[model samples]
Target: MKTEDEWQHCLTPEQYDILRKKGTEAPFTGKLLHNKEKGKYICAACGMELFSSEAKFDSGTGWPSFFDANKENIATKRDLNHGMIRTEVLCKHCSSHLGHVFEDGPNPTGLRYCINSASLDFRK
Candidate 1:
């Protein structure tokens, strides 16, 4: 397992800011937003598999959006940040903030899991 300092060194300033500090990346700037590989998305913090490629889709919302996670692999907390209320999702084990969940999704769960690419590590 990587220590806090190790994670700080492994990620860039912008990546650390968003992934570690619960900040958001600039829209349409993430490389993985357009990725269509068959793989798994793991938490950058502790290497926990969160989302699969099958659940990923083009939401045209700049950031990568997923319909679901890997079978309860993520945990969520109600966020009241920025004077607004939203559900913030995190890695189940590490408690690393991934992003927020919205009710605007395609089907089934009706959840648009808007996540920052910096918070995830793709394994192909």
Candidate 2:
């Protein structure tokens, strides 16, 4: 496991904020929001595969949305911050905050893993 200082050293300010501090990036401003390539989305902090392009879709929520995820690489927790209850997604390998998941999504899984682009790194 990486120490807080080490993690801060390794990640950029935005990445550290979103992944380690559970901060959300601005809507419609994520770099991966419009990505439509075939690849894997891995955790920025730990490099664990999180989502695939096949499960990605435009949810129009301004974040990168996925119908499915590499379940083995993720974990969820109940978030009650800001007077709202939500499920918070994390990278299982490192426990880094990825984003949140919602029930409102397309068919098949009906789950939208609304993730932060700063919390991820793409690979083809």
Against the true structure, whose lDDT is highest?
2
* Model 1 per-residue lDDT tens digits across residues 1-124: 5577876898888777887788998889887999999999998877889999999989999999999888578998999999999999988887778989999998888999999988888999
User: Can you tell me which runs of candidate 2 are displaced by over 4 Å?
Assistant: none
- Go through the candidates in order and give each one's C-alpha lDDT: 0.88, 0.96
lDDT of 2 by residue, 3-67 (tens): 99999999999999999999999999999999999999999998999999999999999999999
Query: Candidate 2 — worst ten consecutive residues by lDDT sum?
Result: 41-50
How many clashes in each structure?
A: 0, 0
Q: In model 1, which regions exceed 4 Å deviation?
A: 1-6
Worst 10 residues of 1 by lDDT: 1-10
